[model samples]
Target: MKKINLYITLKQGVLDPQGKAVQESLHTLGYTAVKQARVGKYMELIVEDDANVEQQIEEMCTKLLANPVIEDYTYIVEEGIVQ
Candidate 1:
């Protein structure tokens, strides 16, 4: 098996309201040192190993996992053993 870890984040110059809100909230909670924060998505998938796993995951990310217009995605594939 293969474990696919995907991370999706907004591209630079895109406004991240959720991250801003979290930062502000942290400041209110006395974490004034918090300067900047950006929120992103992480997803994990377990799939049967294949010769084209990388290509398949890339296509999945582009087609559904991330928005190409404002977000970018990267992934890592690791070998996983299933007993």
Candidate 2:
């Protein structure tokens, strides 16, 4: 078995309105000192078989996991021993 971890984040110069909104709300709630904020997604996948999983996962990310125009993604794959 293998474990794949993916991290998706906004590219530089891209505005994260949602993150900004949350930061403002936090300040209003007395959570000041927040210099900046950004939102992103983290995902983990378990590939139980070795059937071109890496290639397929890369393709999936390019197609839908991330937006090439405003976001970037990176992944890590590790071998695991399933019980």
TM-score for each model: 0.95, 0.83
Q: What CA root-mean-square deviation does each model show from the true structure?
A: 1.0, 1.9
Q: Write the per-residue lDDT of candidate 2 for residues 1-83, one digit (tens) a residue.
A: 88889999999889999899989999999889997889999998887868798898889899999988999999998787483
Per-residue lDDT for 1-83 in model 1, tens only?
99999999999999999999999999999999999999999998999989999999989988999999999998888896483
Model 1 stretches astray by more than 4 angstroms:
none
Alpha-carbon runs more than 4 Å astray in model 2: 49-52, 81-83
Largest TM-score belongs to which candidate? Answer: 1
Best by lDDT: 1
